[model samples]
Target chain A: MTDLLPSPPPATRRPAPPGALSIGWARVALELRLFVRDPGQLVFSFAYPVVMLVIFGSIFADREVAPGVDFRQYFLAGIAATGIMLTSFQAVGLAITEERDRGDLVRLQTLGTPPLAYGIGKAGQVVLTTAVQLTVLLVVAATVYDVPMPDDAGRWLTFAWVAVLGVLAGTVLGIAVSSFVGSARAAGTGIPAVAIVLQFFSGVFFVFSELPGWMQQLAAVFPLKWMTQGMRSVFLPDAAKAAEPAGSWEHGTTAAVLAAWVIIGVVVCARSFRWRRNAG
Target chain B: MTTTHGAPALPAAASGERPAVQVRGLVKRYGGRAVVDGVDLDVRRGEVFALLGPNGAGKTTTVEILAGLRRRDGGSLEVLGEDPAGADRRWRDRVGVVGQSTGAGDALTVRETVDHYARYHATPQDSAELLDAVGLEGTARTRVDRLSGGQRRRLEVALGVQGRPELLFLDEPTTGLDPAARRQFWTLIEGLRDRGTTVLLTTHYLDEAAHLADRVGVIAGGRLVEVAAPGALGAGLRQEATVRWTEDGAAREVVTREPSAVLRDLLAAAPTGEIPDLSVTRPGLEDVYLRLVSEGASR
Candidate 1:
């Protein structure tokens, strides 16, 4: 029997002209647009930290047992440091794993977009989102909650360096963790679980001196502790140093530890990162 | 469509002229066993080359290597006169690909998806014109996740050709398309060929190969078993014709190499001048394909 449908007319459209932007810029723009359109991502990256800051700051505002420091100022610095970790680690890790699970990464490889472009776009998004989060947190801390600002230009510079170091460490660590996770769901849970434990022991929730000796040492090995301590040194008064064993800010040591973590994190990320989830 | 009735035939690849794509003694191994054996292929410029094989025959692996997405274990390969193993940005810009699966971002609309890919090439097609050419104008604002399978496939084709590539790879481009959609896609592909774009397509649908390809290659067990025109594959297979008719109110059929001879016989048998419901049928490309694949499987 003859088929009833009419045959389609031959196509007449012209081919795309040669000469366009490089694929790298196209990839970055696509990634940025997608990330911004996802409302859940925006809230988690920019709002969650502020919510935590307010709740934790209010709860610890009146607890005056620690010597030479007000609890609110100390936690504010710790919360800001934790916010950077959240953006870098949880944000980057889960996003990468989700994209992999969805087969987006594999699609990109076949399209001839280099793997490095994908990673760079992801890192750019994390850094931009973290910067916005930091700005929001600082505004709330300074204007609404009466959290003290850095006392001098030098202290402010130190705070800036600490934030940068914290974000770098977090981004590297997140990429590494994403490479290890089996699925997007696992990444979601695994990243936050590690972040919460680190926050508790890194003195974001309590003074590090109150922790057991081994717990203090264990926390010291992590980058979060150094980030928190460095931020506290910038915002907290000198009298607050009395609670610690040294009774003074060890800015050099904190800087060195964070720098070392950054190096190790970068190595792990580069060595372990996979472009496709199925890549062994 | 304006047919070129007297256009000159394209030149064949000479001994020293560079083939659009060349692969020699290519091999891909996993766990000590080669998935793609020592297969060799040559695709000349301005040719519609179809690579046909059954599932798990390593067609995808071969395409991936040609696309510069995977490394070959042992081979000398060249695409566009440069080694695909070390193809740089310039070489990449010359190639376009539509993989077996739909690879566009599902969250983006059709227009946005086309626009985004356009930026990847030094020169890209206009988004609206590309969409119209691909029959996607009505769904430009619709999200990819919401499009039907056929629409999504069209979008995939649009993205593949957005760069106006010198060479294009289509992996199972019409796998899930309805007959109408499939025919529409073929028209778009023909347009690409008209513009001097070389196309390399892989499909299980033999009709697709027969209709669109200038030459077809059968790949079996990771090897190039045979390559010829779609009608010329499987020697002696298409030589026979099956003639069917009604004799004395009952159906009758006969197979013979010469249908004209059979038609003469049918006219002699019938008392009247006209034969009853006569039809002459030849073996199709699908028959040759199945026979070849089954024979390869047994071996």
Candidate 2:
């Protein structure tokens, strides 16, 4: 049969694929560009944290936690934690759900995009945006509210490790949550609401040691509480450690909990991430 | 002709015989009902094969299975010489799919979207050249969300072929296009055909099947009724021409194999050499397709 028909002109040999890393990097660039283009997402992800910081910082301008640390300075660390969650977990969940609903993920799947590469692209975008978001929050704190930057190298290092782990845990959890959501609209409302409620429980709006015993125990189980605790350790002085529930920063527990969540979130993401909302 | 389950196997010339796609007893069911029931088909490489069927006749389901987008409940199938269900990135790189609806995201510009997807393939057509090929060069800078429906579909085609796939599956590519856009789309597909891309398209429109397909497979009731060249469909029906003429102010019609012989008798009986309103017409593919579909419906 086919032999009887004139054969097609020989296909030219194609170059080997640039490999998954390059494709993943390309996706990162594209995702970032799109993120910048959507003003709604931009304001929500970047501005929400900055605005919260300013509002809380202004309200407590005259109040002081100790000899030098103002209440606004203490609140700034919690706001930064919230910012990380906003950009990584909440924003990522919403983006994935909407993209899945829109069929973009399915299109990429058909295009031979490795799921790892897609995840990399998504994680990269969150990392970049979250960095910018935290910078803006810090700038507002340092310049406007007379809040000092971390003076020592150790504090800066703690900030770096905590930020990386928080973002990683949040991003993976976001993707995993997207797989469970049935529609973009549901994710849109549900993810942000979940983020806000977690903040209340995790002591973002109040000092952690002052919260009720049951609330403290429940908050300790979640990543956001660990993230807020980690951020506070970086911003506050050694004397402030006495105000923690354990009378110390509990750096080991913070690191262990965040790392555990990262592991759990990765496992959940690998098992649950879907290319389409209705995927079987 | 209405149903061909477990159809006769193609003769073995096992060596050097590779169809672009081959399926045996393909079956896909939802709950208790089979949407695609025991379909067997072969699409030769580099030919445009159209699976023509009415809405919900399983054309899309069959095409989706062959494209590896959907799973089959039971079957043995090969696409581009690989089992699609287990096909890897390498296999996907050789296949392109233009789905029934547009899946291109609106956030990126037309050129960016094309270039973005092009990165997925080892060898991709140039984004600028592909846009030009699809007659969308002018709209390259336009945001995808802003493009008109027809333009959006053309961009979808550009994205589909940017991978330079050897086998392309188009599921009802022109379902909603206006006449002019549909013709323009046909020309684009024709260009791809000239480039030797093996195309498998599913369409409910008979004229589209006739215009674009080298061979059309009329499928109904989740089964292929017949697979033949458009002109060769419904062999028995094609032989019988419907002859009509006005006699004594009454219209008379007869179905016959030889329209010329019937005309000769009419000519001899008429005192005047003119046969009023005489018309001899064989059933077109559309008629044959409708008749075949009706038979499938009844069964």
Candidate 3:
């Protein structure tokens, strides 16, 4: 007796092709499209900051906290700084933690996406979202809130530079914080907790001089203090600077400190970041 | 023929054939003990090679190293003729991997997921054709989170092949699939192999290995114990055939090295024209697999 079975087809051999795109723009487009599909994330990213700006603007309306510097002008720069922090630190950090928990990072690793590509994609998303947030806040400030806009090219350029710096600082800090937080829930709370505390001491809501000496020293260590201070330099006059403890705007020092923070934040994020939850 | 230790030596792929993958003296350690110990392997182009192992047998670690996701402590490894340790993006585009972790974005529709990956490769397969190939045409508009496990797995396979990769790594590609889904997945894999795709698969299911693999290698206790064609893995155990017959109003059993000889003897003893309820059985892949694993454990 004999038994016969169908034979497998003969193997066909071919050479493999080369890989492409070390840090491709297409990945950024993909991330942005996915982000927009989440209604909750979209609302929180774009609308939350604008709503806070409105509520705070109305509460401080018609008040002159410093001579020749009204509450509206003072709060405009502070609100913009806060918006950068919210979008870059809280938003990016929580999203990364959620993706890590969901095994998205592990999946991306298998696709041979270079690690630098992931960072570039994330930074692009943060910059784009922050630009929208800044535009909405500035429009409301200028048209509805009766805040003055910068007339000179120098001041407008300064405002643009400060916003860019704020974004870089916030993104680096957010990625660093994300490396330490293990779970999405912890990240959600921890990000907001750190942001709220920094806001208080950085003089976003109150005068920084009123805080205790040790508290003032602690706040100076954070990038938010220098970020808001630099933003205020673009919007406020020299005489108004008298109210600040440093008298004239410390523009040079603020730029230096913020740049240093950006460097430190990047180093921390690189050292501590893990592609997977259980990765060694 | 030149023999090594009185065993028929298998010929390695010839020089200039360009193995799809090669790993020599590979080792990985955890908690001061090696999980993968000095394993050597070569997979020829377009061959369906299966790695069979029990749970916690370091199969995952080995595959991860080949996929360039993990670093090996000691090994000379080459994937697609380049060292995976330092291969560039051009080298990566040649390989595809479907791991246990799913890469699909939960919010994106199935079509979007396939389309998004299509942009990453220079010569990607058409999105419509990829969806049809994976049997996901109906679910193209469905979000990944809403799809069933089988659908998600199919989506993963679609993404894995969209790059037109020459080498594909599938890690337990059929786990969690129902029998019908498993059969369907096998067809897709067979199609891929037919298209000249080299597949390196790891599966716990013996039937899956027996049905798809041209050659299977079994690993136990951090070591590769044996490698053979599925039918030849335990040929010694299959030497005896078991014949069962109904005789004298009772079931009778006999084991013999030669089934034809035994059948002739039984026919002569019964004196009956017809043998009642006659059945011939041989040892299967599962039986050989279980015996190999048990022996490995005992040693």
Best TM-score goes to which candidate? 2
**What is the fraction of true interface contacts found in candidate 3?**
0.28
Instruction: Report the lDDT tens digits of candidate 1 across residue range B125-227.
Output: 7788888878888999999899999998888877787777778899999997899989988888888887778899998778898899988888877887778
TM-scores for the candidates: 0.83, 0.90, 0.85
Predict model 3's lDDT versus the native.
0.79
Q: Please tell me which predicted candidate would have the highest lDDT against the true structure.
A: 2
lDDT of 1 at B130: 82
DockQ of 3: 0.23
Ranking by lDDT: 2, 3, 1
- Residues B1-299, candidate 2, lDDT per residue (tens digit)? 11123434433325675888888888999887988888889898889999999999999889878887777888778787777887778778888889866466687899889878877877777777788888888998999999998998888788788777888999899988999999989988888887788999999999999999999999999989889998788898788899998989999999999998998898889858687899999887778889998887567
Q: After superposition, how far is residue B141 of candidate 1 from its true place, in Å?
A: 3.4
Report interface Cα RMSD per prediction. 8.3, 6.8, 8.6
Worst 10 residues of 2 chain B by lDDT: B1-10
The most accurate candidate by DockQ is 2
Cα lDDT tens digits, model 3, B1-299, are 12223223434457878688877777888878888887778888888999888888778888988888787777577787777777766667778889876656798899988887776664677788778778888999998899999999988888887777888999999989999999989988888887788999998888998999988888777677778888888777778788999988899888778999888888788785788899989877787788786776555
Q: When superposed on Cα atoms, how far off is each prediction in RMSD?
A: 7.8, 4.8, 6.4
Runs off by more than 4 Å, candidate 1: A1-28, A244-246, B1-16, B239-283
Which order, best to worst by DockQ?
2, 3, 1
- Can you list the residue pairs that collide in candidate 3? A18-B90, A19-B89, A19-B90
